[model samples]
Target: MIIGSSERVPLEKCPALVLNADFRPLSYYPLSLWCWQDAVKSVFLERVSIVSNYKRKIRSPSFEMSLPSVIALKNFIKPTEHPSFTRFNVFLRDKFTCQYCGDKKDLTF
Candidate 1:
């Protein structure tokens, strides 16, 4: 009994990437892609707006770097492989207790 307008649609309120019909990356916008806009194959929030386009500068928290704020990116170039056994493994093999003092042996030991 109720009809909703395009503005009332919840899907239209989110920000997403717009891909071309051939499955290529295109421009980004705040509004969600509608069926009338184009054939949206996928939507992702990979890019972060750290600074404005203008000359105005920005600063990150003092805990880390200023320009690159150590933010996580959406896409990873390659999957990370797990590391093999190392000297740390020998320490861990000892149940974190020093073989000599029985004290909790960390990397400092």
Candidate 2:
């Protein structure tokens, strides 16, 4: 949809952070994010509940709403038995400490 003739923030930059049914982020490593288009579609489809919103507003002939900064699912997807193996998850499990030297600074994989 064509939007924002005068607004300074690019629509591309206004991604919404997606959350689980329990109000926790859907993911942390890469972050479960949705683009403005998908986020707006989900709003119309009522698949998510808005948790927070940006100051910007989007309008149509029939309706208008502030752009969502955060949204949560209406349904909960149960977590799998085992968490996926990701570098961020590994770092979290390790408590961000060096596995070999126990150093807590400048960690790198």
Whole-model Cα lDDT of every candidate shown, in order: 0.33, 0.86
Residue-by-residue lDDT tens digits, candidate 2, 1-109: 3233336888899899999999988776779999999999998899999988887888899998889888999999776788888787889999999888999999987
Candidate 1 TM-score, true structure as reference: 0.24
Q: How many residue pairs clash in each candidate?
A: 0, 0
Give all TM-scores, in the order shown: 0.24, 0.72
Clash pairs of candidate 2? Answer: none
lDDT of 1 by residue, 1-109 (tens): 1122243334333223333333333322222233311222111233432211112122346432112211222343342264345556567677767777888835464
Q: After superposition, how far is residue 91 of candidate 2 from its true place, in Å?
A: 5.8
Question: Pick by TM-score: which candidate is best?
Answer: 2
Error of 1 at 98 (Å): 3.0
